[model samples]
Target: MTSPGSIRRIRRIDLRRSALTGGPVDYRRAVPRAEFDVEAAVDIVKPITDAVRERGVEAILEFNARFDGVEQTEIRVPVEVLHRALEKLAPEIRAALEESIARLRATCQAELETDAVTELGPGARVTHRKVPVGRVGLYVPGGLAPLVSSVVMNVVPAQVAGVESIALASPPQKEFGGLPHPSILAACALLGVEEVYAVGGAQAIAMFAYGVEASATTEGCERVDLVTGPGNIYVVTAKRVLKGQVGIDSEAGPTEIAILADDTADAAYVAADLISQAEHDPLAAAVLVTSSERLADEVEAELDKQVSVTKHAERIGISLSGSQSGIVLVDDVEQGIDVVNAYAAEHLEIHTQNPDVAASRIRNAGAIFVGPHAPVSLGDYCAGSNHVLPTGGCACHSSGLSVRAFTKSVHVVDYSREGLAAVRDHVVTLAEAEDLPGHGAAVSVRFSEPSPVESGETTP
Candidate 1:
């Protein structure tokens, strides 16, 4: 850990000074973001995906040996192993995971949408139905942390959405005899998922996209309809490369948090929240945008004091001092809202006198925690909300993983002869205008007289 007094201070950006100059500020450009390039990694990831496509399990074993530093002949984990892991799980930890699962399941149940039928007129009806994906591959990071909670986050929604088949993958640990972390396996067991693999990194994603052929020693792994979860840059790049072959939730980048606080916010609470996210990785972003300069100064001091004693001080220090993480000074709470909206952080926390009012104005965010009492860490585990959210300003266009992500919307149209006749003229006119007479002919032929064959006459 870094020395208490030597911890680096978080940098500051003074947007208030820019506002005073009476010049327009491009908030998006002014905001700090991590330098993430998924496209540049295509050359490195494409070969691995191709190899998995051709060689199947052979290529997966090679990549696992090279990246995960574990040697195993078979990738699929046995059902007995999953049971053993759950059997050995500590009582307290098991209780905590069970509670988290129940809470998330409840939320997912409430989010389920029912089919809706609409009648345009007599004999014309349309129905919108929600269909769940058949199968899904959920990846859990086992690098810095096991992230056992991720199993619950990904599985509960997929299960709640009525997905039938679920497969999970995590890196193999040499210390655990070439198996994934025991906690991860236990969580899978608890969720009633029988298909688990001890694979990791970009190769695991390829295994899901192309699938592995059955070998003499290993059973075949079938391809999944969709893949969801969070992982490192390499895993994210693989998802980007093999997107069309298999569906992906999003190209998730590094974790990030943006706190919109004011003079009423407690400095200690603000400082601790920033450090919590920074502990995830050196690339994680922890930003503070506040109107009160006094609050900003206090947050900085609190960060310096708290980071020095934390177990991951060295890692947190690097993230806090990096270009992606900083403190931005705004003119007032209103300006602070604009800065945060433009930032579109993965997690946005509102800390003001009226957090509800501030939260209502927010137009873009993966998830909003309204008040100092509700922290990002709560959502990560047992807050009944998903932690698999979009990063790198993706919240502006996308959303966090939920029951809806695992389902597809299909429109069912029903029409009678009368319904067809009602719109026949309009269809003919529009089709002719667009030079697509075939579309109109299909409708017109339905109403026209039957052909000789349809009338039971044989052609000569």
Candidate 2:
């Protein structure tokens, strides 16, 4: 409430008055598809990544101190700081952290696949075993809110994948004395991560990629084999620049959601879910595809009415009205499916009759929700699916975080003398046909003595 003596501006908004809201229940013809342009974000990502490569860690730190407003000599969060976070965190926070540990661990255990072996023939064994990267770096955003869930999303998968060492980084908070938010540390502690960094933004990505300077000796460094998690555009750009040096999950982008609804869908529920994701960021996208013109009209009205009540109303408005987001009124469910596939949204929520059947048809999406009960927010917290997903239409080819992101497969080859003899000629023929005599020589060394002629065998 403003002070009585102070001048105050009172604003009023009624969604029913807006034209964007599908009104008068138009069913005569299919509404035009809402035009979505990807060029805008693509234009931003390239430069951001280029700048990170040219400027290196200094560039990253400048952006962090500039945007995040915390200055520090060292980028890595120290041991003492994380311990303090645990010491000072609230009890209820501890309870939630413990519960999250159990739930997320269960998800990881249930989802991860173990190593396998197959016998190609007698005396020959081919094995596929999951090998964790030697070192992994997990990024967590600490700007608007400390994404405690991200810490779990990243760490749990790495642990399940058997990553030897996991390092997590987040922006230092001026409000919290340049320490990562306590909940972030608590989540880390729950997973037994003693290595946490207070740096943030592209710099955090760089610190993990390039390693931080030693405050003590000023000569030592820490490096990682893979970097994972979601961050701002700058962070995404940094990942792009360092991709060749280290593995990255995906080129992260702004958050997004696409809700497919029918007449049976609750307009209020649809609007609420759309706004819920929109509140994430201005660049975030929220699209609603529906077969029912009536439900579309109602949802449009609901967006306005609902956005007014949310805490981040401006963010919701910007996300919902952004060029990438809008309501697509289709001819029917089939047409709606086509639109959604083209969009390839980060999150796809189906609020149609036989939602399971409709959801099963979706071939591209970072994550999915069925019916009114399963919202994207559930996935953000405790839905068992990793919330860190491919965004900005990246769902077209990418996927959400999972145990597989932390694990790599290394083929194990074992062959007995008989096994080698059985395929020796085949291997030698193919190797020679490839036009490199040295390729065949490696195997020929074993029988270079001409194999005693093998009782009428001839060397080709």
Candidate 3:
């Protein structure tokens, strides 16, 4: 239920001329935080993570029943059900998922890369090998939206990375016999991955990383090396707590997007982008830092018009009304860029005419979309780049999941006698300088014994 006043803030297109002034959005008061209790949620998740880590499969099952309302002793989702799921799906959804997968594949191919090798010295050479993790765990959020698009977003990149195994975990629906939505199961089958689990939350993450129950075992069953995708705060916390025991992608938080537009920008386009991100969850932050008061006014009006028609009208209303979402008028485009940089958003769209230049000036963002044509939604689905990204201001220091997220490098040594001799003095000098006599002794051992040729020289 969006209040009349809340709806009034949206500047409709009929009132478009109000945005031309190019004013400033108050940085201090742009968005509010009524229900985004990230700190509290993180605190609560620590216990859940520890419980799952200590109790393993049983704890996960308990959380599944408690949170998702589906109880199961084991976590496996059978193949028969998965096959039937596609048939049960509406044709429109089936077609959409198929198209999205194809589009995403093309995008991933462009972003994925292979490793390289180089030689530093005559005998010292190094090579980088792009090896995928033996196993990866993907947690898809289900409490709110079905997140069928997320199925493609996560698995495609891991598949592109050549990860040997991908284990998917989604909450079980009672209406579906604790099975994931048929669309999701169909997606798993479509991707050619067979290991699926009907589980969710912090517990599901634990089962994947720590290996719970006699349930998920295979012929060569083992714990996963890396876990990815998005979930609620509890899931994010579990990943944080268990990071040392297993690898984790960025710890995501409430979704957020920052749009930078100029006076020439379409108010409708700007408003739609902001509202789309807002609909993800009530806590998602949608911001437009623009140089046009008239544009802001019109976008606010456009938001009022389009928001009424959104499918998730309740969520859309809550998100739009939430303090975390609003239009900010900046002094100019340069100040807008600085505000965006300071925020370090997960998704950023530059809609100004010189979008490339604006994008170039951006210092921090998980993903950047340039021009009106490349909206954040494209990246969320069919854009070849990965969608799982660092969030909650973390883009300042981290990055999104990609092919490189699954690999690690270790130095290999292949020193020959000559190679060892070539660096003996340097090693000895450094070792002696560091007061490590044993290090020098180790290098000196090769020269400790005299060569037989010395005897011939003495006889001569």
Candidate 4:
């Protein structure tokens, strides 16, 4: 085994030998904690948010200069510039983006829902209508990678949900002359998003939550009703603090992938999939919970060979060797499944001989990939499954970004005179039982030509 500090070292947990209390070891306790503390980050971003609230766009520009190091004269990118970015995009990349957009659009359209009308009686009905949010702000991180696919991921669902007004904001790139990366802009153009902004981090989220007051340099954005998309700690913290002000997708943590494999699984395929996720960030977790010691050793060796030649080798190395990433040796395939379920990874891959059976048993995961061919990278780009999934065990309770995330369900109740009469006594009875005489009175008063007890009194 290599030393912990070595890039080649990945923590190995032999659960069979450990003194874990329960039948299944709590995998989460063994995993490395993220450097980002959202609560602590709240303290750091509170002042920035307060400043933005006080000064508006002037504060955004100040934060942009202080944090992003790019001084943008104008926040919103011109529509013409968005179009030009598409025209100049490389043909191969553009073709790929177009295919991704088409695939995602088709999937989103299929997921589109219709209003349901439930008729309780002849004259009364409750219609559950799916309403698209009026306006939204989408964030795209312009960090390590360009993440052009994110533009498609965030924009397509909102479009499918019929969101009329959409605004996208990414960190201003110094290389792009104080604008978001051309690829990011090109994606906006491809999706027909006219409103784009050159901003990023906490400031951008702040800008979206409380729209900047219109000024000489910019027309300013309308405060969005909802905000979706992923970013770093500061971005997540911004979303957390501004939750009530605007709707947010989820408080996403570091990216994670958990592979539940057996002796029959391919070692090379497992290693490649693990490496793909590790490239995202140093905190990105690539966990393998497996029954076969032989397969684990093979994967460890394969990772060494593959990571050495990858483009982002340094980043990938740090991620794999970090406490967050490792291999957990379980007693058997069933135990592996138990371990993964407890971990509730963002992405779970089943590479067993009975992949379908294994995948079907999974209770917690943002998305499940079956067999060897369905890699996490495929889902990230063209799987048609939204890539903005919950991370850091959030898959246990939360869902990924989707058309449903962009829509709000509203119940429309309609009651005729007879229908009101039918439920009036029941309403009055329940309201009175709850000790609210006024509520019962409100219902009884409507049909108060004269109650049986009040027949002697003059009707008002």
lDDT for model 3, please. Answer: 0.77
Please identify model 3 stretches exceeding 4 Å from their true place: 1-39, 90-92, 215-221, 450-460
Which regions of candidate 1 deviate over 4 angstroms? 1-7, 17-22, 450-460
Error of 3 at 48 (Å): 3.0
lDDT tens digits by residue: candidate 3, 150-170: 888888878887788888988
**TM-score ranking from best to worst?**
1, 4, 3, 2
* Top candidate, metric lDDT: 1
- Model 4 bad stretches (over 4 Å): 1-8, 17-24, 31-35, 450-460
Q: Could you tell me the TM-score of candidate 2?
A: 0.84
Q: Model-by-model lDDT, in order?
A: 0.92, 0.74, 0.77, 0.89
Which is the leading candidate under TM-score?
1
**TM-score of model number 4:** 0.95
Give the lDDT of residue 219 in candidate 2. Answer: 26
Q: CA RMSD for every model?
A: 2.4, 6.8, 5.4, 3.4
Question: What's model 1's lDDT at 174?
Answer: 88
Put down candidate 2 lDDT per residue, 4-92, tens digits, no spaces: 23212111112122333665433212222223343444455455445545655555556667777877556656676677777777988
